[model samples]
Target: MASGLDDVIAAETTLSDVDGANGILVIRGRSLDDLARTARYEDVLALLLGNFLGKETPLIQSELGVARAAVFTHLAAVDATILALTPIEALRALMARLADGEDKAVALQLIAAPAVFTAGLLRLRQGLQPVAPDAGLGHAADMLRMLTGETPNVAQVRALDTYLVTVSDHGLNASTFAARVVASTRAGLTSAVLAALGALKGPLHGGAPGPVLDMLDAIGEGDNAEAWLGAELAGGGRLMGFGHRIYRVRDPRADALKAALAELKLAGQTPGERLALAEATEVAALKLLRLKKPDRRLETNVEFYTALLLEALGLPREAFTCVFAAGRVGGWVAHAREQIDHGRLIRPQSRYIGPAAA
Candidate 1:
């Protein structure tokens, strides 16, 4: 067996391709460079869902609007009992109410639930009642409006939209594999999505971005960056954002998000001092990483810039992975459908290495 399923081809998908060696990402026949600059979250969702819906898929922008409102109705269940847990847990508890099924309507709910549920949980945390979703707003903009209970700043909306589109889908990574495994068992889309969320909750996966902020907060200023990063490396601590598991070169998503943050800076949405500090820290960390471990390919990854952009968008650090779920849910639903219609049950054989023939 391939340890950790390394270099394994799990499934055939027209959804997205992750070229780790070349540091490129392609989603549904479009390069990430092409999509990140212009596509809205709804556009990527339509592209992903269209794999199965084909000509039958109506204007998903409005349909997703309806789906957001439908998922909002469930916020009533997010009472103090559920709120007692962490953000992702509370969101998961609320989301579990979505009835398990594989229909197009069910798929839409899975796609839309993350944004609505995340916004509701955030509002309720601040002693505010959940805001209703606007069926007229785009997914990323509406999500921001609901989170803050106000109109979204246009530049910030573009930043968040790029974030959602950038992360919409990738090849079968851990969470996607978990999703597909459940789908192969004929679990409904909701079930598969929940499995993916569970996998993402782990720190090694979707949990990394929040800590990027924690690292920045710990550093606090540009002056302390080199010392902080140096100490981190000396003590064998991994710099959270400087390295990626894939992409020996720079992560393409990092450039995409950094450019988005630049837009926020250009619009004066995020403070310039904050951007300068982050840039300094990134430079210092990269230098330290190369000096300390010359053999390893430790370059800037997506999580580094993700923390900065989402913070500028005003999302709390704790809800970082929930925002991730909001984007990745599109891929989960599409892959689940793909597995259901086109693939067999996923059952891999083991080598029986443990206490064989006892």
Candidate 2:
């Protein structure tokens, strides 16, 4: 048996492929670059769901908008104490109130729940009333409006759409795998999504982006990056946002988000100084990592620019993982459907080394 399932292929999928050696991510036969630059979040969602749902993009968009509105009603049932939890925790609690089913409509609602809950919980925590979903707005735009109670500019919408598309799906990652495991048992989509959210809550999985910003705040200036990073490395600190488990080179998603950050900066949507500081920090960290650990090719990963992009879009650090769930829930839904259709119960055996059975 392979410990940690290394070199193990558990399931076959046509959804997305992670070419780790090449640092390539392809979703539904399109490169991440193509999708991030060109497709809207709803477009990608439709692409991911089309095979199973057989619905057109317009209908999917319409249904998803309705679903977002429908999920907003659940906020009334959420305890105020739950709203006081961190954004992700509050989102998980809110999603737990959704009914479970296997129909296409149910799948749409499950996909919409995280976005609606994330925005609602963030606003509610700020003592701001949650904005209802506008069916006329695109998914990313509506999410921003719901969070901030004001319409977002075009640049903000595009940056968020890029983020949502870039993170929409990868291979069977930890959360997606958790989602698939629950799905394999024929649990409803809501249960599978809850499993995904729980897995994403863990630090190793979805928790790095917030700390990425923390690191930047500590550095505070472009010129201070090298010394600060060197000291942190000397003190045995693991650099947040600098490496990935799957990609031996720089993560492709990192490049996609970096481009989005650049666009935001050029459009004056983000702080230019912050962008420069982050860029300098990335360069310093990469150089130091190469000098300190020549054997490991630890380079910039998605979390670095995910922090910058989301910050530029005006989301708080506490809501980073929840926002990630908003993007990744699309992948979770697609993967769950794939698993339920062609997969089996994911049971594995454990090796026993204790004394003979009593």
Residue by residue across 1-358, what tens digits does model 2's lDDT show?
7667876898899899999899999988899989988999888887888876654777777888899989889888766789768888888888888888777888888888888888888777778877889977788989999988889989899999999999999898999999999999998999999999999999999988999999999999999999999999999999999888789998999999999999998899998999999989999999999999999999899999999999989899989999999999999999999998889999977889889978
Looking at model 2, report the run of 10 residues with the lowest lDDT sum.
51-60
Q: Tens digits of per-residue lDDT for model 1 on 209-319?
A: 989888989999999999998998888898988777667889999999999999999998998988888999999998988888999988999999999999998999999
Residue 18 of model 1, lDDT score: 89
What TM-score quantifies how close candidate 1 is to the native fold? 0.97
* TM per candidate: 0.97, 0.98
Which residue segments of model 2 deviate by more than 4 Å?
none
| Cα lDDT, all candidates | 0.90, 0.90
